[model samples]
Target: MRLADKVILVTGSCTGIGKAIARRCVQEGARVVLHGLETEWGEAVREELGADKSVLVIADLQDEATPALLVRTALDTFGRLDAVVNNAAWVASSNIHTTTPAFFRQMLEVNTLSAFFLIQEALPHLKERRGAVLNIGSVNAWCGEPDLLAYSVSKGALMTLTRNLGDALFREEGVRVNQINPGWVLTEKEIQRKQEHGMPVNWYELLPPEYAPSRRILDPAEIAAAAIYWLADESGPVSGQVVELEQYPVIGRNPPKK
Candidate 1:
């Protein structure tokens, strides 16, 4: 019960890493506001955690007004807010040449802009509680693969936002902000995406050794554990930090080619 009595708003909590984080928070004695596009999953989670411990909110982050509404709903339901985990994102493949203005804008709006507005709308409540904000970033922020150009750029901007807000909020309002850039994680969505991209049926078992040096990819629960640490006071007074969760060094080391 590390987060006993805390009230947390976790965006994209319907699935994947976000779901894991929301579950972990509830397990640690926190009341969670779960937001995402999947109404079914959200309702299931809400029931699983019980009505008193969780609230389900369905909102499209791409909408400009949704951020404020999400904050309002959480406050109305729980009467207070303690932490926020911005984890919803749209990950699509697009190189420089292939990325159109519309595509780029869509990516930024969903991946980065929504988080910015969410933090803005939740600022007052967060300040009142000296709360924390945790942005779920991607390892792609550091010059991602060519196929992920726009997505990478969006994540890079999110990283900057995390740093800038982490510093500013900590100094001005005692609100802590931090981020986690996760490497490849095997989620339901990721597996479906791989299949859509024409990967073999046994793709996980067939992954190149270089990419899967440990014979496995990260699990959503692993990322959740890290998020819990940052959102909880157990992390102390840390802020403006970006922890990259990956199997290999993200900087300078080149994996051996097959």
Candidate 2:
């Protein structure tokens, strides 16, 4: 058990990558604090993981007070904290001309500002424990996807935050900070996006014969595996780095030729 006896908090964990990370943490002998806005799904995850091993903290990360409340809840229930995975995000697909100001503000508030506040609130506890912080971001942070303007921008800021904080805390506190960038994942929302774009249900089946990149879209467990590695003692020396999760084109490589 790489994370034995650790206490981990994962935000937006009722589904998708967050839920997967929480499950992996529990499997590694860690007590998990699950945070999310989804009440029914959060409770269901709590039950699925066993009530004794996991507890749900209902929070709307978009709110100003949520970060402090999350830290307090974790400490109140778990006695100490070992790690935090800032995995919650908001996505609104819009080009610059098409995006409303409110939409842009809300996207930043959810994706970037919330992370800033959470890190501020979690700092003292993380400093005390010499814990790890993993910020979930999109690979588009570097690749520059024009269609996902606001989301890409927010994730780009997240990448910068990870590097800057990792440098700031490494020498004095021994805390590690890192980012995980997941590629096109097969989540429910992604499926909806494909449908909206007029792709068939079996889109993968329709790929051209020459498209030789991995046939599988990223799985939640695969992302969770990377999360576990980042949180584990093995990654203590690795900070200020963005580790990507997917099959091909690992980090800096371009997409497969069309």
Provide the TM-score for each candidate, comma-separated: 0.97, 0.93
Error of 2 at 192 (Å): 3.0
Model 1 agreement with the true structure over 133-158: per-residue lDDT tens digits: 99999999989999999999999999
Candidate 1, superposed: residue stretches over 4 Å from native = none
Model 2 stretches with alpha carbons more than 4 Å out: 204-212, 250-258
Candidate with the greatest TM-score versus the true structure:
1
Best by lDDT: 1
lDDT of each: 0.93, 0.86
Q: What lDDT score goes with residue 240 in model 1?
A: 94
